[model samples]
Target: MKALVYEGARSVSVKNVPDARIERPTDVLVSVTTTNICGSDLHMYEGRAGMESGRILGHENMGEVVAIGEGVDKVRVGDMVCLPFNISCGFCRNCEAGKTAYCLTTNSDPLTAGAAYGFAGMGSHSGGQAELLNVPYGDHNCLVLPEEAQERQSDYVMLSDIFPTGWHATELAGLQPGESIVIYGAGPVGLMAALSAQLKSAAQVMVVDRHPDRLALAEEIGAIPIDDTLGSPIDQVNQLTNGAGADRGCECVGYQAHDPQGDEHPNLTLNNLVHSVRFTGGIGVVGIFLPQDPHSPDRLYREGEGEVAFDFGLHWFKGQTMGTGQCNVKAYNRLLCGLIEQGRAAPSWIVSHELPLEQAPQGYRHFDDREPGWTKVLLHPEESG
Candidate 1:
């Protein structure tokens, strides 16, 4: 099988690798159809996340189940399924509590409490960015799709990650149906957050970014595009809300938070969210924040404890409640899937490129650079036309 492997900083290659096979009684073998390049993947691609060479680099995946282990009773061969990025046991204490993102049984290291495919520090599971992928706990991990799965691969594939992640941000922020919300970052996840806000019938949805292209996408969805380059985002939200600020806020920029000049500020988005959300409002942050980043400009982030200096005083004075973490995808995927099946949602609108597996390198380059019109890229492992 050919798989995407990390070569080094800002480099990757497609090379022949060992075939994927069922390795456990509860495992399933999948012929991967669609895979995604995620913003979080950039952390590894840029060499800031300590990704080892020879690691397959995808986590958002969906495909046809080619084979199922004897112990897998619910999933069957030929079923189209989307695998959650988190590799949870479904029987762990955390899983039982609806916290599958922090499942206790998946990651090998005892210190790590969560796991995901092809992610650094998440565990040993290989990702689904190849012709074949081995999925463990198949009965629990696979979310079987409807009959329209094949024709709607682009839309359904998002069930594997970003769609649910975006919805998770809304849930974390405690967004109410009639409330207004502002989301920082117009990247894929943030865009999905905007979509989720709309689907939930928010009175107003505002997206912040310096990228004209991304902000334009936000406009296409009827969201107010707040170009941070034009003025202070806090001021923009305040004006939009008639001086009260938005009802809630979401932080999707994570630790790579930066300004239009490309200067990295690990806490820029967080501080902005704190000030932009109305007093006593809630904030949900689904962006990836590391305890430390070797590539970060802040000395605290470079030291393995990714703590950034921010205004805890204002956060407390404002009495804002906050939620932050990797999204618990399973918690919202089913509900969102129903919306897709009913033709009420179309997350695929964010997909900007569809390339054959062989062209992954080019896709990564353009996406990494945030090239115009390359907002999101999906790779077809079988190289279908």
Candidate 2:
């Protein structure tokens, strides 16, 4: 089988790799139809997150189940499914508590509670960016789809990550209907955050970023665009909310966040959220933040940490509360899938490129550069059956 293998920083190549097959009795083997190149993938592509060479690099995945282990009774072969990036063992305390992202039974490292495919610091699980993928805990990890899934692979696949992740941000922010919210970052997750806000009836949804294409997508969905290139987002949110600041703020840009000029600042969005959200309001951060990586080129991320000198004093004075971490995707994926099944949501609007597996490296390059109209890239592995 051929897979897009990581070569090094900013370089990937399509290489022949062994087929991914069922490795456990509880596992299912999927013929990947549509897989996503995520913003998180950029962390590795840019060498910000050190990942091993030859690691298959996709987590947001959906496809038809080609084979299932004898122990996997509920999920049958030929069923379409979307696999959440978080690999949970379902019986763990965290999974029992509905925090599947931090499932205790998956990550081999005792220090880390969560594991993800194709991610750094998560675990050793290979990703699904190939002709075949091994899905563990099939009954617990796969979200089986309806017949409509075949025609809507792009939309259904998002339930595996960004859609639920965006919703998780709002949930963490405690966004209420008719309340104003501001989301930092206009990328796929940010755009989905705006969409989630609208679905939940936010009084005002403001998206902050300098990318015209992204901001335009936000506006198309009824969100007020705050172009950071024009002026301060803090001021814009203030003006939009009559100087009270937005009722809530969401951070979706994580450690790679930067200002409009392309200057990287790990704390840029965090401080912006603290200052822009209304006093005593809630904030949700779903962006990826890793521990110190001694080899990291960025000073802030050196020594395995992405440290920032943030204004906690201001945050405390404002009486604001915060929630931060990876989105425990399982907590919300199924519900979000229903929304897609019913046509209440259509996140595929953010998908700007759909390419074959061979073009994945090109997809990675353009997306890493943030080229125009390359908002989200969905890759299709050639069918094996």
Candidate 3:
């Protein structure tokens, strides 16, 4: 099988790898159809995240089940499914509590926070970027798609990660119908967060980013666009909200946030969110933050320790509440899928490019550079029966 194997910093390629097959009684082997190149993948691609070489590098995946273990019963051969990036043992205490992302039975690393597919510090499960994937806890993890899944792969595939992730951000922020919200970052997840805010009937939805294309997409989705390149987002939010600030705010840029001048400052976005929201408002942070970054030689967070210089003072003084972590994708995907099936939410609008698996490196380059108009990139592994 050919898989996108991570080479080194900013390097990856389609390499022939051993075939993926059922490895456990609870496993199901899937023939991958559509996978995405996510910003999270870029963290590994640029070596910002410590991923081993030869590791298959995609997590946002959708495919058809080809073989299932005797223990797997929810799905069978020929069933199209979307695999959530988080891999959990359903019987764990955390899983029992709806906290699948922090499943206690997986990746028992006390220092790190969650378990996920194709990520360092997560379990050894290979990702679904290749022609085949072995899905563990198949009945619990694989989301069986509807009959129209093939025609709607682009939209359904999002249920695996970003779509649910964005919605989780809003839920974390305690978004209420008719409330005003501002989301920082116009990347795919941020854009989806804005979309979710709209779905919740937000009276005003504002999205902040420097990219003109993404800002335009936000506007197209009924969100007010705040160009960080043009002016101060904090001030703009104040003016837009009649000086009261947004009722809630979301931080979607994570630790990769920067100042208007493009200087990397891990806490910039969080601080911006704090200032953009009203007193007593809530803030949700869905951007990826790491305890250790292998690519940063400057020791931004101390070796093996992920710490950001957050404005705890302002957050406390303003009496704001906050929620942060990887999304518990299983918590929202089923219903989101139903919404998509009903023609209500079209998450696929964020997709800016589609390419074959062989063109993954090019897609990586464009997305990593965040080239103009490049918001999201989806990859298709050659179909296999």
Candidate 4:
């Protein structure tokens, strides 16, 4: 099988790898049709995340089930399915409670509670950025797609990650219908957050980012684009909201957030959200924050126990609430898929490139470099054959 393998920092290669097959009775073998190169994948690609070489690198995946294990009763061969980024046993305490992201039974390490394909510190599961993917807990992990799935792979594939994650950001922020919200970062997740806000009927949706191309995408979705490069994002949001600040805010940039001049400030977005959101409002953080960054030049980030100084005082003084964690994708993908089937949501609008699996190396380069027009990338593994 052909797969995109992580070679080293900012390096990847398309190589023929061992074939993926059913490893357990509850597993399913998928002929991967579509997969995505996520922004989070850049953590490993950039060497910030310790990813061992030779690990396949993809988590956003969807495909046709080529085979199903005997224990898999619900899923069948030939079914088109989107696998959530999180791999969990549905019977786990967390999975039973709809918090599948933190399933206790998936990761073998006691320190970590979640498992994800091709992610560092998650689990041993191989990624789906290949011709074949062996999915554990098949019936529980595979999200069967609608009849239109074959035609709308671009949109349905998003069910694997970003769309639900974007929705999760809003849910965490406690966004109410007609309430105004501001999302930091206009990357793929941020754009999806904007889309989610629109679907939830936000009275005002504002997105903060320095990238003109990304901010333009936000504008396309009727979100007020606040360019941070021009001035203070807090001031922009405050002015836009008549100095009351937004009713809700989302941090989608995570810890790698930097200024327009490319200076890394781990807590920049968090503090920005604290100031941009209205007093007593809620904030949701969906961005990835590492427990440690050994390569960080900042002493606090290297030794503060995953802490970067943010405005916690203002957060407490303002009585603001925050929800932080990876998204429980299974909780939202179904309804979001229904919206897609009904022609209500089109996440494919953010897809900027579709390439053969072998081209993933180039895709990673462009996306990591934040090249213009490379908003999102979908890779077709089958096309590589």
Best by lDDT: 4
Off by over 4 Å in 1: none
lDDT of 4 at 283: 100
lDDT of 1 by residue, 1-385 (tens): 9888888988998889999999899999999999999999999999988888889999999999999898999999999999999999999999999999999999999888889989988998898888899998999999999999999999999999999999999999999999999999999999999999999999999999989999999999999999998889999999999999889999999998889788998889999999999899999999998875777888877885888888899999999999999888999899999999999999999888999888988899999998999999999998833
- Quick one: how many clashes does candidate 1 have? 3
Model 4's lDDT to the true fold?
A: 0.94
Q: For model 4, state the Cα shift of residue 138 in Å.
A: 0.6
Judged by whole-model lDDT over C-alpha atoms, candidate 3 comes out at 0.89
The TM-score between candidate 3 and the true structure equals: 0.97
Tens-digit lDDT track for model 4 on 1-385? 9999999999999999999999899999999999999999999999988898999999999999999899999998999999999999999789999999999988989878999999998988899999999999999999999878998999999999999999999999999999999999999999999999999999999999988889889999899999988999999899999999999999999889999899898899999999989889999999999997887766788788678998899999999999999999999999999999999999999999999998999999999999999999999999985
Error of 3 at 208 (Å): 0.2
Weakest ten-residue segment in model 3 by summed lDDT: 295-304
lDDT of 2 by residue, 1-385 (tens): 8777887889888788888888889999999999999999999988778798878889999999999998998999999999999999999899999898998978889988999988887899888888888988999999999899999998999999999999999999999999999999999999999999999999999999888899999999999999998998999889998999999999999887877777777788999999999899999999887776554446756753567778999999999999988788888888888899899999999889999998898899999898988899999997422
lDDT to native, each model? 0.92, 0.90, 0.89, 0.94
Once model 2 is optimally superposed onto the true structure by TM-score, how far is the C-alpha of residue 49 displaced, in angstroms?
Answer: 0.8
lDDT of 3 by residue, 315-385 (tens): 99999999989999999999999999999999999898888898889999989888997899998997422
TM-score of every candidate relative to the true structure: 0.99, 0.97, 0.97, 0.99
Candidate 1 minimal-lDDT segment of 10 residues: 291-300
What C-alpha lDDT, on a 0 to 100 scale, does residue 142 get in candidate 4? 95
